[model samples]
Target: MSMSDLFVFGPLAEAATFEAVTVRPLDGVPARLPGYALTGAPDADPSLVVREGAVVEGLLVSPLPEAARARLDAYGVALGHETFKAQVDCEGGAPRMAEIGAPKAGASGPDWDVAEWRDGQGARWALMAGEIADHAPPLSPTSFARQKAMIAARASSRLRAAATPAPATLRHEARAGDVALRLDAPLSGEFFKLATMRLSHRRFDGGRAEALPREVLVGVDATLVLPYDPRRDRVLLVEQFRSGPARRGSTNPWSLEPVAGIVDAGETPEQAGLREAREEAGLQLDALIPIFEGYPSPGSSTDHFHCFLALADLPREESWRGGLDEEHEDLRLHAVPFDRAMSLAQTGEIDVIPMLAMMYWLAHHRARLRAEAGSDAA
Candidate 1:
C-alpha cells in the first residue's frame, strides 16, 4: 500500500499526540486546507466544515506508514469521522492530494484552539489513541466506538495515575526500568475492561525477578461519600442492589452503602463526589472532608476509591428513594443516627467496606465536626 499524506488541524496537529498515533517518523510541513473551517469545544475533537473562502491552518504529514494509517483510521471511525481525499496547499508548494478525517455529518462547534486542548485533554486523548490502536485489529471499529466511553475513562484513569504523587519515604523509590512489561492484552467486557499482563519488576533484595502473569479487572476511579448531618448527629445511607454480592451467590444482594459514582473522564474526584451526593440522595453537601484515597484491592483490580465525609442537612425522614433513572439505580435512602450506623457496621449489617471505612472516619472526627458545625457551614 502506498503511504498517503494526512492533513491535521486538530489535536492530532500537536506533535506529541501525532507521534502517539504513528509508528514511523513522518515529517510535517505547514499546510492550508482551503474552503474548510475548523471548529470544536472543550473535551471534543476538532471538526472540519466546508465554508466558502475559509482556510484551515494545519500540518500536512506525508508518507504516513500503512500500519499508522490503519491506526488513524480506527481512531477516526471511533470518533464518528470519515476519511476523505482533499487538496492541501503546502507552504511554498502547489496543492497536493491528501487524506483527511472529518465528521461524517459535518459537525461543527465553537472555534477550536489546539493549545488550549493540549494543556488539558491532550494527554488523555493520546493515551486513548494508543489503546485504540492496540485493540483495533481484533476488535472492529464499530465495536471500538461502542466501547469508547469506557476507553476514555480508562485513559483518564491512566492520566491521573501518572500525575499522582507516590511518596517513597516508607517505600522503595521506584526507578526507571524497575518494572518491565512483557505482555498486555484485553481479556473481557465493554463497561468494565479485564486484561492480562506479564511483567517483571525489581525485587526487594535488589534483583530483577522473572516476568509473572497477572490478570487485572480494569476499572475507573470512583468517589464514595458518606453524608453526615453534623447538627442532627445522623448519616445518610443508600440501599441498592449490588451485582458483586449477587455474583458471589449471597442470599442478600441488596447492600447498604454510601453514595458512590465513577469519576468521569474530565471531572476531578471532589467534583464527582459532590455530583454523586446529589444524584444518589438529592443532597446539597455543605462540605466534603477527605477520608481515604487508595485502591480497594490493588492485587486484583484497578478500582481506586476517593472516600469522603459529606456534611449535609438530613431532616428526619423514613426510607426514601433516590438515584438516577438512566443508571437503573433504585436506591433507598435512610437517615440514621451516627451511633446507629456504627452499630450496623459492628453487627455486619453495613457490609460495604467503603461505607464502613467512612463511618469509622466520621466516628473519629464526629466531636470536632459537631463543635464546629455552627461556624463551618458551606
Candidate 2:
C-alpha cells in the first residue's frame, strides 16, 4: 500500500496550525522540493509553484490514516488548491513522493512567514477553518478556488465582536447559554457568503422557542465617516453613483455620502474611518467620534457598521476628486455648509440612511462641538 504523504511549504508546515486544522499531530521530517518556490499575495497563504533551479524546504506529513486523508483533500478543495505528486529529498538525500499544491497566478511574495500570520490572524482563521471543516464533506479536486478573502473577512469580524467588551442589560435570558448556533454551508463562495444556520433561542416569558432555520449574509465590518469642520460650519460629502439605489428603481443613482470603506481584516474602525476620509474626501481627519457600532440588518445578515463623525478641515472651494481608480470610484467632493446639509436632509436630497443619521447627530451636537473647538482655539 502507498503512503499518503504530503509536502507542506506554507502555513500547513507549522505543527500547531496543521494539527488545529487537520485534527492530527504533524509527524514529519524536514525535506526539500527542488525546482519549486513558495509564493503568495498579501491576501493569500503561500502556494508552491514551479520555479526552475529553486529548492523549497518543507515538511513531509505522510502515512495519513484514510479518514484524515479524506478531510485533508476536502480542505485543499475548499481552499482552491490542488496537489501533485512530487519527489522531495529528506535525511541523507533519501527521496520521497509528496503531494504539493500547484501554483496559480500571483506576484511572488517573500518566503512564507507562518509565525507573522499566526500572531496577526492565525487564531481567527483557525476558528473559521474548523467551523468550515466540520461541515465540509468531500469535493472534487477540480473545484475552483474562491471565497478566500471572504472567509478571512468574516472570521476577523466575528472574532473582533467576540473580544469586544460591552455592557449587558437586564435581558439576561437572551444570553449565550440561552441560544444554540450552528453552521450549515450552502456552498463555497467568494466575496459574498450565504450561511444556512439553526438558531434556537430562549423566548421571553421564561420559555424556549422553536429552533429557526435562517440564512446569514457574512458581510464585512465597515466604517462610514462624515467629515465635518465645526468652525467653518461645513461638511465634506462625496457624490457617487451607487448600485443599490439604481437597482431599487431610483431615477437618480448618484447619491451623496460621507467617506466610507470596509474595515479590512485586523484593522480598527478608527483606522478605516481615517483612511476612507482621505480616500473619499481627501481630508485628513482630526478627531474620530464613534457614533455607533451596529448591524446594517441584524435580522438576516452579519454586516456590521462602525459609524463615525470625523472632524476635519474642509476648504470652501476646491476641485478635488477622490476614490481609488482600481475600484472604479469616480467621486466628487461637496463641501457644503451645515445649514445646506440640514436643508438637504429635510428636503430628502440626502437620502442615504447613514448620511441622514450623521447629519442629524451633528445637528444635535453641533453647538457643543463648535464650543469645544472655540475653547481649543482660545
Please, what is the whole-model Cα lDDT of each candidate in the order they appear? 0.81, 0.74
CA lDDT of 106 in candidate 1?
Answer: 48
User: Positional deviation of 150 in candidate 1, in angstroms?
Assistant: 3.1
Q: Best by lDDT, which number?
A: 1
Off by over 4 Å in 2: 1-10, 13-44, 47-71, 74-113, 127-148, 173-176, 187-189, 317-320, 375-378
For residue 28, give model 2's deviation from the true position in Å: 9.4
Candidate 1, residue 173: CA error in Å?
Answer: 1.0
The candidate scoring highest on TM-score is 1
Give per-residue CA lDDT, model 2, range 1-378, as digits (tens). Answer: 336578876666766557756779888899999988777653456777678898888787776777666566666666667666889998675798877764453676766556677777677767555534543554333332334445666778888888887676654524567888776553444466677878888777777766688888768788898888878878887889988799999999998887888887778889878888877766776669988778777898788888888888875744468888977889988888889888988998889887888789888999899988883532
Candidate 1 RMSD to the correct structure: 3.1
Q: How accurate is candidate 2 locally (lDDT)?
A: 0.74
Model 1 ranges with Cα > 4 A deviation: 23-26, 92-94, 105-108, 137-148, 374-378
